[model samples]
Every structure is written in structure tokens, then in C-alpha cells.
Target chain A: MRHYEDIAVGERVELGSYTVTKAEIREFAEQYDPQPIHVDEAAARESVYGGLIASGWHTAAVCMRLLSEGFLNETASMGSPGLDELRWLAPVRPGDTLSASVEILDTRPSESREDRGYVKNRLVGRNQEGDDVISWEATNIIGRRP
Target chain B: MRHYEDIAVGERVELGSYTVTKAEIREFAEQYDPQPIHVDEAAARESVYGGLIASGWHTAAVCMRLLSEGFLNETASMGSPGLDELRWLAPVRPGDTLSASVEILDTRPSESREDRGYVKNRLVGRNQEGDDVISWEATNIIGRRP
Candidate 1:
């Protein structure tokens, strides 16, 4: 188990691989996005993206999956206040394998609270080709055990 | 039909409303996020957030829906180059009606090309209760009519 005490500033955590599937991307886009470039392959071929592409929101959602399966499973995580920045650096296509890394940037207890602390981390998601897909910083409130 | 040649700076586009639902939020959480606060209302009630809350990505997805159904539907848009910022200021719950507004900050055409241009815009989303739920800035490549 990863207690608040176990995490250090500048520490890096490598999240394992995640694959992007046409079915998954299509499902997500159909429900939330429904953009031609994201859901319809033939239309995507004629669109500006040049091919079917995963929605940027889908890319970020996959990154969140990595965060959960890799880091949150072992940590005493409360929840994040929110993200500060979210950038879709490049398009994600079906069949790409996504890997991620997180860096601890800052940690501090709430000024008014003793048992709860916050950790700021920079999360980066990359494709199998070593290209960045999404990058953002997340601020999470965690519980500190006495 | 709205052509890409017409979207000018300082223009404001009002996208329609999106209604949040517990089922949609839960399904999104199950597939990608699965955070306690996002997946289980009971667990969420015990958390610091004190109630069932949608995932931040879920909120962003709703904002995207508003953009697609209204703004994108009216414009000859290619695709975004990227997003500059995304701030999730508050939680969104079931039954929240999300409305969005886009401010075109700048527009620049490809100097060497005749068929494409870029637009920078600030997109803000508000919940039914009049709370700012999300704010983001993005750059998209728009198409020009022949």
C-alpha cells in the first residue's frame, strides 16, 4: 500500500501499456462525441483528420484509466481537486498502445486541515511510437495517516 | 450553411444544453475511470465531495456534445490542433443542464495555403445552477469553401 508518506517529490511512476481499439473509440464517440472523424471510418477518410481518430476526450479518459489501474490501486487517494492543464498533443488512432508516466511535483497539507494533504502531479500519456498523446497536471487531495 | 470563411474573431457561439444522467456517468466511469466518487453514489457520499459527482472527463464530454451539436454543426470545421487549457472548477451531477459559449479569440489563415485556416477560441461551460463547470481554450483548423 502506498501511503501519503511513501510518495516523494519528483518521483516517477510508469503506468503499463493500454491499447486503443476501434470498438472502444467508436463506442465512446458514438455516445459522447459522435463526430464523423471519430465514429465513421469512410467519412473520416474524407475529413480533415485524414482518417478515423479517437476523440481528444477519449484520449484523456484512457489516461485516467492508467492512473486508476497503476497508481490509485495502492495509494490512499482521496480525490483530485481537478486538473490544471489538458493538452492533446497528437491524434490517437485505433491500434495504438498507450503508456503513461506521472511525476510528483508538489505535496503539502491543507493549511486548515491536519489529516488531509494534497499532491500535484504531471501526468503524461504516450503512444507506442513514442509520441506524446496527452499531458496534464493533476492536483489530488489525499489522506495522510498518522 | 455557415462557411469557414465567416467565423471571425470576437464572435460568440452559444451551444445548446446537455442534460447529465447517472447512467451515463456510471457507464463512463466503469469503462475508463471507475473512481469511487464517480462510480458509486454511496461511496461518493462518504467522500469529501459529499455526494455523487460526475467524472471531470465526463463533464468535458458533455461540453464537447454541446460544441458538436450547435457550433460544429453550424461551421465548416476541420479539427482542433490542440487545447491550451482545461479547468474543471466544480462537480457536475445528474440532472445538471450544461450550456456552453465560445469566444473566438483569433483567426489566422495559412499564409501559403488557400484552403485552410486556424481559429483560437475560449470555451466555457456552465451548469444548470449557473456555476462555471469547465473552461478551456482550443485551436482548430477550419476549412475554406472553394
Candidate 2:
């Protein structure tokens, strides 16, 4: 398993991809962000978006899924204390394929805890056209290997 | 519908609440977080947390849901450009009831767009014990009444 020591600053990793679907978008919106632009096609058409758009929360969650599957499982991850910033730069629509990429921005061992280190990662989710739909800076706590 | 002029800085509003459930936590984790501490009960018990914890993303989404139900439905919101910060200060467990509160931090007319304004709000989600589980600063674009 990759430990805190195994990661390096500026190292980039390809996280995985997910295809957004109309049904899933509506389902997610219905449960978590039931905005008309996210849940109703007709209403979305009349909104500023001019079409249904996946909730930003849904896109962010998809990025988390990709990250978990791609790296967290193989690492000594200790979860996160928080996110620094998050933005929805563009809209994600049904049938759009989104991919994630992560870059290690910085790392430092915790002074209060000897067993873990903190890593800052910049995560970006791009649409099929390579346009960024979501971007965030996440800080994760990782266990150090003995 | 409430417009940009309707919200005042420092105004606090009750967003709403949601009760966490075991099945819902697992289901959300399976789709978007899949970390052992989030998805598998036994593994979570063996982890540092000593019990299953809901994914922070799930908690954030619940906060979004509450915000939508509380105010978005009655407001001329044009969606958000981004969030300044998000933190999961405490663990959320099954059967734990969560609630949200929103305080408008700032508001200004859009410089480039006369039709809309920008609003900054601090959203906090607390558990049954009144401990904050999730908190964030959100900036939303709101339409101005004609």
C-alpha cells in the first residue's frame, strides 16, 4: 500500500472516468439538489442553462468516487479534514463523459500526530471536450508507514 | 419569489434537517465514496473511527438538499459559481439527525450584469447534539426583481 512517504509533490495521477446519464442526474437531483435545471428537462430548457445540467454536488461526488477507486484503496488513507476550495466552472450534461486528474500540491507530516501526514491535492474533473466542470483543492490525512 | 434585494447580510435562516440512516450511508458510499469506513460496517469498526462514518461528501450533499428545500425553491437563484471552503468537523453516523443553518455573509449587485447580484452565505450543518458536521461558504448568483 502506498503510504504518506510514497507520495511526492507535483506528482500527477489519472483518476478514472464516469459518463453522466440523464436518469442518474435526475435521480441524484431528486434526492439531493432538486433544482429545476437539474431535475426537469422542460423546466431546465426554460432556465438560464437552456438544458438539464447535473447538480454540481453530483459531479463533485463523482470525482470523489473516481479518486477512491483509483488511489485511496491502495494507500494508507486516513480521510480528510476538509476541502480548501471547490468550483463548478462548467455545466455537465447527460451523455457527457467526465474524467478526473489529481496532482499532489504539497505534503507535510503532522506535528501533533506522529502517525500521519497531510497531503494537499488539486483535483480537476473534465468533460469529454477537456473542459473543466469541477475543480477543488482537497487536504487528506494519510497514515505513515512504520 | 425572493430576489437578490430580499436577502440581507448577516440574516440567519433555518435550512432544515435530515436523519442519517445505515442503508442510505452505504448506498451513497457505494456510488460515490466506497471507502471502507464509509461502505463496509465491519471494516469501519476496525478502522480508527471505531464505527461506520458517513462520507463527508454525503453529508455535504444532505446540506445542499436542506438548503434547496429551505430557500432555493422560493428564490430566484441562478446557481453557484463556487464555494470558498467546506469542512467536515465531526463524524456523522447512522441514525444521527442533521440540520442546517444559513447566514448571509455579503451581497452585491453584479458589476457586469445588471440583471443579477451575488450573495455569499455561510452554511452550517449540525448533528443532533448541535455539533457542526459540515460547514461551507457558498456564493450564489441571484436574479434581481425587475
Best-fitting candidate, scored by TM-score: 2
Tens-digit per-residue lDDT, B20-131, candidate 1: 8888889888878888888888889998789878888888888888887778756777777567567788888887888999999998888987898888899999988889
- What are the per-residue Cα lDDT tens digits for candidate 2 across B24-138? 9999999999999999889899988999999999999999999998988789989999997899899999999999999999999999999899999999999999999989999
Candidate 2, superposed: residue stretches over 4 Å from native: none
DockQ (0 to 1) for model 2: 0.89
Root-mean-square deviation of each candidate, in angstroms?
Answer: 2.1, 0.7
Per-residue lDDT over A1-146 for candidate 2, one digit per residue giving the tens place of the 0 to 100 score: 99999999999999989998999999999999998899889999998999999999999999999999998988999899999779999999999999999999999999999999999999999999999999999999999998
Q: Least accurate stretch of 10 residues (summed lDDT) in model 2 chain B?
A: B69-78
What TM-score should be assigned to candidate 1? Answer: 0.90
- Kindly report which residue stretches of model 1 are placed more than 4 angstroms away from their true locations once superposed: A1-3, B1-4, B111-114
Model 2, position A136, has a per-residue lDDT of 97
lDDT of 1 at B44: 90
